[model samples]
Target: MFKSIAHSLAALSDRFFHRANIRLKLFYAMLALIVALIAAINGAGHYIFNRDFLGYLNEQAQQRMEDMVPRLEQAYREHGNWDFIRGQPRVWFELMKPAIVEHNGVVPPSGPPLTPSDLTGATLRFSLLDAHRQLVIGYPNIGPDARLRPLLLDDTIVGWVAQTPFENVIGAIDLRFQQSQFLAQLIIAVVAVMLAAFLVVRISGVLTRPLTRVARATHRLAGGDYATRVEVESGDEVGRLAQDFNQLAMTLERNEQLRREFMADVSHELRTPLGILNGQLEALEDGVMQPDAQTLRSLKSEVEHLNKLVGDLYDLSLADAGALAYRQTDMDLLPLLRTSVQVYGERFSQRGLTLTAQLPAAMPVHADGARLQQLFNNLFENSLRYTDAGGGLHLQASLQEQHWHLVFDDSAPGVPPEAMARLFERFFRVESSRNRASGGAGLGLAICRRIVDAHQGSIAASASPTGGLRVTVVLPARFEEQP
Candidate 1:
């Protein structure tokens, strides 16, 4: 039965809270917590007051009974029996009065007088009994409920005085005092609850405000509003969350810009070669030029350039998506580097440039050899096409601690300092130094970077000490046997 009730309550709670907004849910949660605390404290206060207050009154009654013992003994000594206070309300009242002393500078009256403050019914609830334990007078109900004190006369037993504590608070003044205490507790609990609710509402608002803004901004960002951002209000977790959200939005915005630029660059790169091919074919068809070896060669060269551009674009896309096929083997990069240099050496010479190399004889690494060769060939081509006549290009390699470091330094016709940072961006060209009229379509270095990254390596470009562009590649040293 209890389990079913608990399950019902849980389902009801979920129904209310599952669809609620965060701020309202948090407010209700905090409010419930404080209300439970208030109920617990109020219950504890009531229980303690009911128990301890009665105990306190009982203690005061016992003290009064003890104090009246000696007085009763004195009365018994004077009257020779319990008959003096027996059935005499006046005598009993006088006997129960508190001992008198000087009040300020005045003396109390010389009589057994009743004070208005003794409202615990101690005077009337008392009983006197004989030495044989027979009740003389007082409250009729006297049995196990009595608190007894012995009366003594000259070290001998005289009689007994008994009292009953104010356990039920029957008198008007005592009942009012008890009721007032309960009322005061109720007022305090009500005020505390109201104040707690106010403070919790304000606090919940303060905490959830930034979260609300972030949620809205996230929705906007999902809706393609990449420029969405939130103001950071503090240096806390919530503030950091806002910072991260703004950063995500900024990244999306930047990526959107790059995507548009990529499409434009691709279109321009394709249109140039295609337009040239169309123009040449139109001239031949109109009989404006002879179909000789020179015309055929020109047509073939344009087709080759267009084919190379499309191939480079395809390879770059594959590399960017991490879908490039890598036929890795245990091969020394030195041999591959030398092979590319040998192949490109003639081309560099044809362009009136000298190529030199200072490579280590062997550098073991587990990598895609063909991709590395492609990387080497592209670097050589970039230098081959850009360097001025009679200038040279230098290739060097060495083993750094746990990695192979290769540097390519070529002679003049250097990349501009301003373009160094974006040297490896796809389709980027330096307008001042390296133009489209120069040889590369500007994707070689970008592909090289992707290949190096796939090998768990880093590539960077800087101003070479040789007054030209410097490309540095660092690849981790590994072996198929070691793995």
Candidate 2:
């Protein structure tokens, strides 16, 4: 039961402390620290001032008492006893006063004689006594607590002077003055604390405003508002954070657009083959078209298209998931390149395009032969489908600087400069139309990119000198192979 109660109390405390917003927490923390610092400074200042000021008053009183000794001895010598000084408060006070003038100004000799009331401000009190230790003059309340000094005449002690330490004074005026000082200090400390708190609140607001914007932007992003952005107002870490956040938002926005396009393209690509097969089967069932070799071949071609699309999608998924199978081998890429060109050279010719090959006898590379064949097939197919009739197709290969460079250049109609960068993006097509009449699911270049990347090579597309798309493939060469 005790453990449960303790846990409940701890949870409640956590809720209380943690429920406050960051701005409030920061403001309170800064305000508390500033107030504590100011309080400590003021407290130390008061302590030192009180100690030093009291010490100075005590020193002055001690000096006055010592000076009174000579004056009392002169009076005693003239009177030959304490009779001249006894029962005279004014005379005792005058005798206690220092002979030298204070630095502020000198007092006139005809000025009013000092009294116990006058010395109260200085925190000093006095009493004069005779040779027999009898009280003569000064404060009636003087006791052994006061310091004593001897008054002498010709080396014989005439009487004793009893003086109070500055600390012993408890007069109303002194108490009132101390209370006023304390009140002033208290007021000053309160004002300082209030001012510090106000400044802390303002500073906390300034600091937390950017964080608030980021939080709001995050909320919007969570709600699928990928277009949300924040303004960067400084060259500090917070500003950098805002910049990074903006970049993240832009990437998310671009991804969202791509995702929508991918879904649409997938649906359209699927529907085309499915619709053709459905229409053909329905026509055959309705006796509108006879089931002949040509009809069967048409259905088979549509099925193959669907199968190819599905296979390409599967390959992409595997590559994205880092699960694509690769059978690496050390082999001559020159023979493989020659075989791919020979296989596609007739297709280029069938389309009335000139296919030229610039070959090297041997180019060695460590790669998957089947994937490399597929990569070359896709590039040739792209040129076959997109290049206009009578255009030229060139296949060039060379080994340079421990790498194999393959260039595929075809004549116009070519892809736009702006479309070149996104040519390798999945489901991206320069045509903007989802029709497959030109024979591609737009996954060919994307698959080619994955193949080259898996081999630790780089691929890029640019404008050819023939005003066509120039595709460059660079792969690390196995230079140790003599063949």
Candidate 3:
């Protein structure tokens, strides 16, 4: 039960307090506080006024009842009681006058013996009650069962007047006026609180709505949606946030612009030399000069290095632009692995690196054939480049759950843990100085990443048990063929 109550309270608080913008939260908080205060004040005012009014009315009723007690006692003492009431004598006319004025203009009948018709509209009526419930009275209007104030005599209980009316004319008038005033005040309080709550809600929404919009824009910006911005309609916190969001978006866009410009600058710096070297090499090969074998070999090697650099740059450019193409097909991967190994057989033999392929006779995969070939080529070249002389390089293919897994393990210096994470970042080199020595322009893994992504697969690098870098590629065994 306690947990249930706690959950209910938590849900209620969440609904009332959790908001998307600070300004909206503040506005709601202030409005709720104001409403609570107003309601408390209104309730207190109603309670006090109603209590005081009822107390005053009750006190006045008791006071008049007490004052009439002595007059009724004197009348009973002087007159002959029940028989005298029918006679209705005028001997006590002066005494009744004061009581008449006190009882709101009600007066007893006077001047000669009066009939019941003559007593009509009088300020007071004299009455008597017998043990048999019979009215022995001056008029029929005051009956034996009529409600009346008790008449006491010298601290002794006596027979009561059966009925009586208020003697003061102004008492009823005053009461009617007080009732009207109280009702008006009560209505005003109710209306005022209701109007105030409504106006507060409307004005708060007007002020905080823009802030909500700006908050959403900021969230989008933080999520790398640089294109998002808000329009400022007022000179306020909301407007300031809008202005800040626009400024932030501009700054991010400009930084991105500068980064693209820097990449272009680097590309131009590397490409210019390759273009010049290629032209010079063509000119030399046209028999412009008869170069020695050693000189020729040196120039050819330089040309090859230049070609590699240009190729790496081109691959990086395509990957950055998301423009790498693929030609996906479903085929057994074993034959493809054999074919790639055969092309690099002479280089592997020369380097004294043992290249071995361990693959299933038939393992089906749906992927781009040419792109997959390029991907494997990069892995093989990377392994051969780093593997020490007489070291072993192994290629394996197998099935793992829904994916076809390809792995390359070589005996070479494994990648450092710190550099492993950034291995696939464009132009990110593990050893900046030594990368060029190994004919690595640092774009191989990046290209492999794009190819794997195009095939909706994953490629990762880890330490192999052979104490070398292990490259693992996993692709879905079958894909819906793209038309």
Candidate 4:
């Protein structure tokens, strides 16, 4: 039995706290408890305080009756002058009305003295009784139901004042006063309980207002409204949590922007080379251009560029999926840098440019050799393609800390400072004024970036001191051996 009760209470508490919808259950429950408590307190106070008020009124009435008793006794004993007592308002009106009796030439042992004030509208009854308890003088109006107050001298009854009909006596109790007090107490308790209930519900609403705001913001977010953020004015935990949520939403929005930009860049890069190849093929088939060696060579070059672009796109997809394989091996950094420069040396020389490579003798680095070679070749090709005629390009390799640093600086009118930030972004080209024919597919640096990143390294571009572009590559000095 006890376990069942505890389980029910626990379930009630869970519903109170965890239920998402506000159907006014808690508010109603709190209001009811507050009202009940207020009524109990007010009821107890009313009973305690007003209990004395009724007693006081009843006591005052009793005291007035007691004070008038002596005056009535004196009126009967001194002179039998009932007129003196009847004429006095304090005695006759407040206490009782006087009654006159005839003695019938005999002294009575006792007689009724007076009638009560409540019997003023009724007929007065007079009676004179002899010492033997026999009535010597009696009025026919003296009914048996009359209430009589007896006059006494030395313990002997002289006469009596009688009021016929008991209705007059019963009316003197004055119960309306008690009823009024009770009504007043009830009114006060009801008003107080109602006021208390109102205040409890109002305060509960104020407390839960923050929760309501948070719920609204969450709903907006669920509808794909990333801009919705909770702005709480208080410094409470809810306020802090709201601030944190807003920050998280902002971060997610930024990441989504980056993702969109990356995709656009990828599409632009792939489409440019494909468009050139398609146009060249259509021209050849239509006989607009002869199938000469030069036209065929142009077609072959565009096709090669398209192939590289597709290959880089494929590699990026693999990298994003965390499926890019890295075959790590210890190799000399200088030989790799020298080899990249050698591959591009003939092309640079043909363009009236100088290719210089500065390498430290035998600095060994741990990396995937094939991927590292690809990284250098991509960077070199970028510099070679963008540099002006007769410009000089520099390649350097050295050990920096526990890592290898390979850098390329070209003295071409390199990428503009404004465009340098996006140089490594896929499909981003710095030469905005250059048309598609001049600007090769722009995925070279992006491919370089992914290759370097897969090796757990960094690559970025800066404005070279030589008034050209400087590309830097930093790779880890050691590697974890593959199992």
Please state every model's RMSD to the true fold in angstroms. 5.8, 6.3, 15.2, 15.0
Q: What residue runs in model 3 are displaced by over 4 Å at the alpha carbon?
A: 1-322, 432-436, 479-483
Instruction: Point out where model 4 deviates above 4 Å.
Output: 1-17, 22-211, 232-236, 255-263, 431-436, 478-483
By TM-score rank, best first, the candidates go 1, 2, 4, 3
Per-residue lDDT tens digits for candidate 2, residues 265-356, read: 99999998999999999999999999999999999999999999999999998998989999999988888888887888888889999889
lDDT of 4 by residue, 1-483 (tens): 999999999898787755734536655575577668767886786676556643443344343344444655675667664544433444445333333455697654464443332233332233333334344333335556644556577887765544344232334344675577668877876776677567667865776687778888878877878888887778888788788878877887777787887788767776777788889889989989888999889888878877877788788678768787889887776677777778789988997888998887776777788888777777777776677777888877777887878778888475667887787776677654322355665677877888888878898888887767898888877644799
Error (Å) of candidate 1 at residue 50 is: 3.8
Location of the lowest summed lDDT over 10 successive residues in candidate 4: 117-126
Clashing pairs in 2: none
Q: What are the TM-scores, per candidate, against the unseen true structure?
A: 0.74, 0.70, 0.48, 0.56
Model 2 per-residue lDDT at 71: 83
- Tens digits of lDDT, candidate 3, 190-265: 6765666677678768876887787787788788787887888988776777788799899997777657865875
Candidate 2 — which residues are off by over 4 angstroms?
Answer: 1-17, 46-178, 200-214, 231-242, 325-331, 349-354, 400-402, 432-436, 478-483
Q: List model 1 lDDT by residue over 1-483, tens digit each.
A: 999999999999888888777756766777678778878987887788667976776777787777778887888888998767766888777777878867898887996444433665567777888788788877766768778787888888778787765664367876898699778877876786677678767887898889999999999999999989999999999999999999999999999998999999889888988998899999999999889999999989989988988999999999888899998877788878888889888998898888898987688998998899888888888888888888889888988888999999998778888899898999888886656386677899899899998899999999889888899999988645565
Model 3 vs. true fold: TM: 0.48
The clash numbers for all candidates, in the given order, read: 0, 0, 12, 11
